[model samples]
Target chain A: MTLLVVHSRLGKHRFEVAKGLSVREALDITALRVRAACGGTGACGACVIHLVGGEVSAPTVAEYMKLGSDERAAGARLACQVRLKGDTEIRLDRPAPPSPWKSIPLENLKPLTHGLPELRAHTLGVAIDLGTTQIRVSLLDRRSGRRIATRRGPNPQGVFGADILNRLEAARANPAHAAELAKLVRTAILRAVRDILARDIGEVKAMLAEIGQVFIVGNTAMLALLGGRGADTLLDPANWQGAIDCRPHDVTPWRAKGALPCAELVMPDPVAGFVGSDLVADLLATGLTEGPAGALLLDIGTNTEIALWDGATLHVTSVAGGPAFEGSGIRHGMAAEPGAIDSVCSVENHYRWRTIGGGAPQGFCGSGLVDAIALLLADGRLKPSGRFASPPGPDGYPLDPNHPNTAITGPDIDAFQRAKAATAAAMSQLLIQAGMTWRELRRLCVCGAFGRTLHLGHAQAIGLLPAVHPGLIELHAEAALAGCEQALLSPGGVQCFDALTAKTKTINLSLLPGYEDRYIEHLRLRPIALTPTTGQRP
Target chain B: MLDRFIKAYNEAVFETDKEAAFTAVNTALAEGIPPEDIVFKIVIPAVEEMMSNITKDPDANLAQHFMTAQIAAEVTEKMLEKFEHPPEIIGRVVIGTAHGDLHSLGKRIVMGCLKALMVEATDLGVNVPAEKFVDEAIARDAQVIAMSAMMVHTATGEDGACKVRQILKERGLEQRFKLIVGGAPYRYDTELYQAVGADSWAPDGVNAARAIINLIQQVKHRDSAQDI
Candidate 1:
């Protein structure tokens, strides 16, 4: 075994692995979550981590192909590409570009100053997280590619009803109402832009010049409908949706799709349709292909998706989970914003939490959800079946009997169960298909905002986590977003996306057998020891 | 006694006639029996018998579950229309889908239960706008905005109901209405509900009707306390 030092943002996470093992092998031994999409065959850029120090072997074709002309200068070598002949020091960083269109930070550099109009060195672009439950926007300087300002408020379109499907249907039936929605987006975006312009520097026109790109990252329907493309059918000409084109995936047609009119459209290349570009972008940003340790990546949303990497193959599946994380499904839930309840605690058999706004108590966020599950499990309030032993004492939290949002309902438990089942089933199926089990895997890295706040123990308590030892499970905070930032770290990150398509398999979950049964079995909030009481709960 | 009656009827009658179960439940309710008593005692037992029958034969031509749902809806409508607006203050609310909620049966059940509970309410139906919720609240001044989210995916209109609330704020009507969301796909986490910025929620009809009145009074009481 050769000693290797794995440097991460949190300091040194080191390991000693066999010299015959690739560089990715040592990092994998350490706490750094580096995965080789091509099973160390050096086919995917996902396993690309930097050799920060120490003399390592030469780069492999996968690493060489993944890096751009600029990144090669900074000692950026793929973890799998190099062989270890001596003691090596490496830094764990994501490999390749989200796409060539996205990684070009040089082209994106703009020099905008305080104030709109007239002229500025750069432009301040706004990126909106237009979710079904909540909408958030981050303002970035187009020149420096830095987020100088950020703002989040409730999406004004909520009044029409709740959820995107409802919104889409409404828009489809009423074109004028759809336009009104667009006007609202324009007004809101303009207001934020204007406020920045007014407080900072130039007038609207001058400020506009500073923005090199306006990347609108969101779930698909949001981009489609908000861009006024919601009603577009395949047969329409000029299926224009008022788009603002930017090359995302860097595919030739992706660049052309940017030309197809959408309401301030940009690159949606990574993921679209029901899954949305946010997830696909997050996947690219996080680089799931780096791991072959039989890891699972789950991004929870209105539609929860799970993907598994089995050393040699990748399998993906989606489950119908609610907008629980966004706070829409809960009685008093809010977005993970300033006033939302981001964390929860259970003391003396009762649940308590600090709200986001930090005032009177309200609802929970994804983090709070983990804590709630933890607290509930600790107090024996929930079983794997997902039923609560009725909120403890008779002082009875004054719950709303009819309000499904305020109380734990069977369906609610069922939903959570299905979600867990989906994840567990996906994990199980992936492992089963790949001829292994989650327990057999050396490591399971949890990524995305949903997992960061979730307790691995609690997730397992509710059977959400696979039947693996707690020691094997680890959390990567904002791994996708962090991965996005990681993609930006060294030079040539944008141009390195070629390594992405080169290595990886997308396993569709529809083929799995025990999947449906596991899904049905998992549907019970608590594991059903006996037959579950369906109709109405007393 | 009620369960036995339902079981007997379902065995003797509904074995061949699929509609017999509904007829039996309706008959049980006509003798001044409570609806919960009807569901818990009669309907539930009858359903059990029907299921047993289906299991025993396996080839009995049972009408589709949705058809049964429609028939039940008709029965509920008939039962609800006969009440002629309860004289006492059971409670008053307006229930429906958001502007894009085309799924209406769940909303109907919500309405039926309110009527069953003798709570006076305006049935706003499905696919209502947030503006309509506001306008209707101002008009009917509804105590609770009871919304049944059938398709979990389509509960909220464009961006979901919260977007509507954001719209309400833009339109200067944030504090004017209270919101309550329910559906098969929904869960009850008060903070989750409030996180979406709604007043409250209920899981079932009995609880929902009572919760509506309770939340309404609480809001009014808080308002008066503030005024005082």
Candidate 2:
């Protein structure tokens, strides 16, 4: 008999359960942090968790490849992989946000050049980036994914709330909010079309003269809300059953049916409701998504999403990292907009960072966060365990509310540490599942738009990424949108995507024992290393 | 006490607080504190705080923020309020959120800073439809009509400062008001202000307040030259 401590993040509740029982069974005992991505199959690694100390319960080969030497050394193990052997701790890092693979479309890929059988070309193809605070729609030439024109505006839906859950919960709270969200999205599209074509607001005919198809990608709940499907309908995987329950993706959900007279709504094939089409498209863009060869795609954003593509299988997981990195969590936070501190440095454990648009930075965003955390880790400003070490150097100082310059405080570091831990843990889970050692990972791909701006060396040094020797990691430019482009470009691209999706076996890592202790160990921001320039953080 | 710190507050020194205002009035009543001090310190800072809170939450209601605004508005009814208040040092500014646009964190921060040292702030809370802007300007005899918007769609659309100018032009009050804009909307194009007929722009509410103050000082300098 083994003891797996299942602790709830919201409440101080923990449940000890027997070994070999699935996390699905544990869900009955404790509604803990694990949000099953693969529908509890050892298939989607989203059920991936951090293993604390215990007898090595062992994960599927797919689960072993996502881990790093440090994680495994720290007693971290995937939840979906190992059965509970003895007294063990298991917990998820903050809910992983959707770190959609940075899938930017190729310049010429499009879904419609007017032809093809069984194609829903009239579906007004649009790939929407439904940001937590802003709604930006890119009207693809679906024929080319060339993004004929892009339109963005503040999410009028934010009038009701911010974040998808907020918008969804708002609709749940008041039906009108649902209607309002729909109205806002369409109005934005209408306004976008008119402005782009320089035509009348209602002139959809003129706007579509050159357009022939449509596809949309957003948070799963958002697509559901847009389709006028309520929460019950939204959460029911049976409605999304083809993608989750069965290995093969059913194209039926994207049949372009909706309550509103809007463009055809193409739902990105979602993993779990949390890891939806954006991520699927993201996975597509990342190239070489799953199998035992072992490659991990970590994207940090409003929702941090990670996927382990082993040579033989793909383990995908997500944690709700929240708005902390995107400049929404802290006071004075902003997006990667002008006046945002997108990059920060260590002034010998103090803090000095640069703004995106420059000027006295109003606040920090994701890039700045990476810089801050990595810098702190290198300079001993933070501990290897992600705790604020309060670098006893001259540059070390406490975070002050009144002083705008006091950017990364002890508390902010913890937020970053937790975020980094979740990310590293997910990656670790993939390596462990693959059964391929970190050195054997063959290649590590940093997948994200933000990943492009990251310092690779800094990432490794701080333990946010595996310590695989450089040259092994290949950063994919835009993995999610690339998949969207693929879906739009080749006639059989969607089917191809469906086939590729089927090949992926989502392994639920949460059910694996010893997840909690591993996550706790990875929480340290201070890496087991040192670098110069740790003294000038101002 | 109020009069003593007005200049420092404007210079961004010794941050301002509501208690400063109450202290001015309380001291004036308790001792032989001058009425000028009472007006400048206690009343002015208090009003600044009142106006600032309306935008602190971005989504907070105007009424929820500044119930004291009405009190300040009534107090301004006095003749001495003019000499004591001096709403022109930073300029006779008009500021508010755009129609159907309500997110006032920056707007109120600007209002608080400006009005703290006597910039007259006409704060219209979140989602003040376009029409009300025109009507209010005429009613208040405002100098600088500034508006804030945080939405990307509205930012590009004619909602905040753009609407203010159209209304001003329509009423033949163009020269009567100096048009201004700020908020999330202005990021795409600064020349957009000129394209949409705005006189000037600022990145945030604080900068917006500062810009108006600078413009007023320039205009004042010209006026003095003409008089000479």
lDDT of 1 by residue, A208-303 (tens): 444433455455556655666544331111221222222322223211322211112243433323344455445555456665556666766666
- Among all windows of 10 consecutive residues in model 1 chain B, the one with the lowest summed lDDT is B58-67
In order, what lDDT does every prediction score?
0.50, 0.53
Clashes of each: 100, 119
Q: Write the per-residue lDDT of candidate 1 for residues B56-148, one digit (tens) a residue.
A: 542222122222222333344444444445235444577766654444544544454454344567877556766677667767766667776
Report residue A5 deviation for candidate 1 (angstroms): 45
Judge candidate 1 against the unseen true structure and give its global Cα lDDT, from 0 to 1: 0.50
Candidate 1 residue-wise lDDT at A332 = 57
- lDDT tens readout by residue for model 2, A1-538: 4445544455433344445655434432222335334323355455556665555456666566666677667655555556655666655664333221111222213233442335454533555555445554555554433444444455566666666655665665566766666667656655544443331122344455434445555556655566544544443223432343211132333332321234444454566655656666766665664433666666666667766666656676666565666666554556555456666665653566665423456766666667766775666555543434543323224233345543554445545555666676556665566664455666666654353556677777667777777777776544554566556655765565566666565544343333432443355443422121211211
CAPRI-style docking class of model 1 based on DockQ? incorrect
